[model samples]
Target: MPDIERKFKCSSVPYPPIISCIALLISMRAITWIGFIIWLVIRLIIYFIYGRKHSIVQNESKD
Candidate 1:
């Protein structure tokens, strides 16, 4: 059998307009204020669940 290469592609996402318009007024803003806030909330939940393990690894690498 011959070897074949597969490529990965990402599709564009539609951000909501209301909060996003504020972000567009700024430069290089991907998600507007609403997106940013939503992201933070998700990140906080992930960190609360996994932060301890990551902190241990970070400390070991630093020292």
Candidate 2:
């Protein structure tokens, strides 16, 4: 599962930061901030709900 997650993140994560950088240069409007806030909230919720439970360090310590 961790391997799969690593693979997925490798493919997906880098693009978002790049895209967000571009998006920021394109606009600093209200909607962009709103969307960023919503994205952050969702990320936090997911981290608390799932990521914290399934983290690699926690799994390794069990072994």
Candidate 3:
């Protein structure tokens, strides 16, 4: 079970950084704060949706 959980956990770790990096690069080129804000909102939404579900607390409860 932990091994399966690790696979899910490992996959998500790279996404946030990659997304933020892309957002930062685009904002730099476009010279607009909106793109960064959009990215932040997206990240927050993802956190609320997926992050909460995969949290340690939630996993502990499952056991």
Each model's TM-score?
A: 0.33, 0.40, 0.40
Give the C-alpha miss distance for residue 23 in model 3, angstroms. Answer: 19
lDDT of each: 0.72, 0.84, 0.80
Best by TM-score: 2
Question: Tens-digit lDDT track for model 1 on 1-63?
Answer: 346665753454354564587565775555566798899999999997787667887769888
Off by over 4 Å in 1: 1-31, 52-63
User: How many residue pairs clash in model 1?
Assistant: 0
lDDT of 3: 0.80
Error of 2 at 27 (Å): 6.3
Per-residue C-alpha lDDT of model 2 across residues 1-63, encoded as one tens digit per residue: 544545333568788999999987688888878999999999999988797788999889999
Model 3 lDDT per residue over 1-63, tens place: 644545333558888999999987776855357787899999999989897888999989999
**Of 1 and 3, the candidate ranking higher by lDDT:** 3
Best by lDDT: 2
Model 1 superposed RMSD (Cα)? 10.0
TM-score of 1: 0.33
